[model samples]
Target: MTTTSTPAPPRIALHRDRLLPAEPATRGIARELYAAVRDLPIVSPHGHVPAQWLADDVPFPDPTALLITPDHYLTRLLHARGVPLADLGVGVADPTSAQSRAAFRLLCRHWPVFRGTPVKLWLEQVLVEVLGVDLVPSDDTADDLYDAIAERVADRGFRPRALYDRFGIDVLATTDDPCDDLAHHAALRDDPGWHGRVVPTFRPDRYLEAGLPGWADRVDALGEAAGVDTGSLAGWVDAMERRRAHFAEHGAVSADHGHRDAVMAPLDAAEGERLYARARAGHATPAEAETLRRGLLFEMARMSADDGLVMTLHPGVSRDHHAPSRERLGTDIGADIPVAAEFTEALRPVLHAFGTHPRFRLVVFTIDETTFSRELAPLAGFYPSLYVGAPWWFLDAPDAMDRYRAAVTETAGFAKTSGFVDDTRAYLSIPARHDASRRADAAYLARLVADHRLTLDEAHETARDLVTTIPREAFRL
Candidate 1:
């Protein structure tokens, strides 16, 4: 059997009206609205791309390392198809090893599995628009596709800072540990040649979770980093305050919370201190740890209220759901599963305490779409401090985004909702994801115009606001 190396690949032209309404009249409105905001500078107020990628300004290694491995969106699907992660370069000692080429080949072979999925759309967009690679990915074209991309990656023009500039990103916020010194963020900001605005966000999940292994060590490390003692709950709070202040001194405007639930029922300070003290001494039980976690969440809200860091909370996902996979490959390899989340009752304790506090800004994200119209939108509708976060993580698909807009608009309207957030670690997908968001919003706004719910002018304005003004305001950028 002979392999056909020069097989004709499908043309990769993107439709001008993709993701817009199918009806001619409404589609025309969506087309105009999308064209207006399609090239708007992306205001990425919430994301997971590392500041170090830009700070180093290094050329990306290869296609697999750049596109496949770091992106759980791609890897999880491939893993589900029984393509071992190792073959996709998941946990290899060297990403440049032979496994990378195999990974790319395997990925191309399995590309059809990504059909009708947002990941496929994003990857195709990246390949066509971002990478400027001409061929569609498949077993027939994998080698040439990989070689062409590898050549581009080897060029200085394809370096992180260069791509950051090319992406037209106005601002990028990265998730950072509270204990992180944010040295890379500072370096990027301070570099005379670099002018991109990259900011840090305070994330203290490990230190706050008392039941987790290495939580004690993380607490001690936070104390060391902040020059404060973590002897008690109050001292730990002090340490957290110092770190938040430090993050602010750099460029942070928000603190991100990722937990199984959004608990804010405050315990007695003394009781909370006792719980922490027991944990510090290795005598804390699981129940005590749960108490400490909730109390710490309450304390965190108070701290946010006091210090004015926008509190962005998301719950209802069981992280690292497959323990065996997580243990073998480490965490965030995308084995997590989403569960139903209760925001109304779960957040009452915190909302009652700080919902009206003028300084506090609470933005809540959820994978559980069930809560949007029923619980989240209504809650955000009333709370001055609460803003409904954009459909994020598992809910960033096109239909999900459309559903999100329809769900939240009735109660919270456009202003009370956090605008599109590209919650991704895949750096190049920033614009593709943002583009998907703009098109989705344009389509939604066009429907409102067609239904006589909003004027066409109003819909256009809302589309622009969703792209720029709303994200800036929600994250307080």
Candidate 2:
């Protein structure tokens, strides 16, 4: 007797105008607009893509680690639905083929949780568009799908550098610590076989927050890296400046900050030093630590004003909301949460000092959507130094992005907004996420054209700038 196997679900598909307008006339214009910029080389000005990955040019260890675990959006949602991080291969450095296959199956069994989300969209692209997998993930077909992706990932065409070339990335910037040696960046820049651009953006949040754990060690490391003493606040400042110079020399153009609030208060030189001294001695209270943090914000603006590194500030994220999970998994493991942020008053001090400075440039990002029209847009409208960053991270979904365009364009206009930034640690999601933003922008611009607010030619040119020139100019790339 011959037995026939039951076939799996249909192969996945993406609509050519997946995010275009609902109206027929508007969809027509959006289709034209999307076509113009769909193939433009990606310009990623700010992200967490590890420079080491590109420099090493290595094959991905496994499909599960590469596609499922590193993505907080995927892991966090699954965690919310009663999945343990360890079961998904969260802490394992080099998972075995069996363990990796198990995690992939876990993800497949819970696939319904990802329905109608940006994470789903990005994963679909990675599976179908990038890997050419035919199976839609589900419990019935998990093992087969895993084998299919695992086989593709092991091929030479799937190596990091080869994929980078295929992704059409022109400029890819990575977020990094001020104390980092950036040796990987130097390696990529100097490699003859590699032509991809991977630059670093200085991130000094933990080092500035004195009350945070490991501040003392990080401060010492910064001093050692810069060849400056850290016994005094002035020495610390000098060390920071030296590191910033080093970063710029190796092709960095910007610095990034993720403050709990947007406050940038002025401080006297002696007073600032006194607070820092107390912090080093482990005597500063939380209030003192916060004050010192705000004061450093002012100094950071002062330095950027002098050295010309564009400042990208995203404030009001309540990180490590789940204390136990954070303790177990460490930072950026999907435990962070968003909170309301204030701007006008908190930023007045720095804005007044550097708002008109020729060398200073600032791009502000918020997870607080209420402030988009009420605060950020108006501030960007008035200050020459200010621009609104892309709606990303928590707000990278379709509706929030469309709302972002509507909220800011009236006050700041397209010219004063930072172009789309795919801020991900996931290398494979780079083009997929950027494609989402492009489609969203096309739909929004098509509406403007339909409403007679913009001409088709004007919309076409704006689409080009949003993907290419805006990010380049905003980050000074």
Candidate 3:
């Protein structure tokens, strides 16, 4: 007699209560809190997704490009495990099918490296939840999973804008250089067929870093973009203000800064002009550049006070910490490492100037977790214009997020905390990142409820606000 048997179930499936508390009572409350906001429209006030992708609304080439290549969070880990970035199609404009397939296989074969990581959570979510791939990633399942994802991405309905809608993103913000023409943003805005709200964020980090190579040329480019002559400090300021106006006219709600530190100091006009000349002439010492950058950051806060653009700053990053990696693959390939940050003293000058300014809004972010209670919470508690930014960058993990809520909520309360910011370049992982944040927050709130610190009704209300009202108000959306 021959017997037919059902195939074994897939190796792994996402747990319905993956990040919920282990205790039954807290878990129940968390499940309820999560259900209330699980399907809410995503409000991404800050990210690095390119505007052109949505403007063109093109179908992604393959799973590797869509999932593995563009996400440094994955690529950097793969690179650490003896994989060359080039082999992973890191900078390849159009990777051939074979190349892409190999990269995907490599990722699958090395999936163990991502265990206990948020990358694992996001990948599993994307594979099963987003793309409907049932099989777990492994050496044996790489080809099948790749084929499945490739087929899905090839469909017209899987185009960027379609996915944007499918992701239920109410508002997505893309970071842009000060010299950008924003033509792609204009295209999306003018397209009558599109109804999604995508806004540009003015990121002026490169323009402010006088110590970087080609600072003068970039300043000149910035001036040309704004139709001004940036020959002096005052001229540069005027050019930046005009470009900001242009951004505001095009619906930008925030200005982003990612300097090395959070220092914002004032400079006299004479000293500012002198430092500007030195920087432009390529003769500025490191100290002079530091002074100029800090003064310029102070000016940025001043500009925000005047223009009503929310000033968002994430500092304490030592960008390109690994010189060889940067030289080999250029920057932002996840070599950026966080250093200890001192916000209390560094931000004193800027805070004193704009902390109570009615029009000024500053959201400060850091990867350094130590600042949560010691510095950020107290600052946010006292300053009407300041909001403690969510756990960001490396600290965007579950435990860190729970710690953040515990640390800040005591002093600043929920209202003074900026809602979760994805802060990602991996466009496809946006939903997964936000989902992780939501779950972490729900778990935290459930603990509060279980501990009698908050009622269930209050927890539900706060959960809703975290994903909606908080982000809108924090980013001034």
Best by lDDT: 3
TM-score of every prediction relative to native: 0.97, 0.98, 0.98
* lDDT of each residue in 132-239, candidate 1, tens digit only: 986777898899999999998899988999998999999999999887889999898789999889999898889878999988898989999999988777889899
Candidate 1 has its poorest 10 consecutive residues by lDDT at 90-99
Q: What would the per-residue lDDT of candidate 2 be over residues 225-279, giving only the tens digit for each residue?
A: 9999987889888998999999999899999999899999988998999999999
In candidate 1, how many Å is residue 323 off? 1.0
List lDDT for all candidates, in order. Answer: 0.89, 0.91, 0.92
lDDT of 2: 0.91
Ranking 1 against 2 by TM-score, winner? 2
**Deviation from native of the Cα of residue 72 in model 2, angstroms:** 0.7
Q: CA shift at 59, candidate 2, in angstroms?
A: 0.7
- Tell me the spans in candidate 2 whose CA falls farther than 4 Å from its real position: 1-7
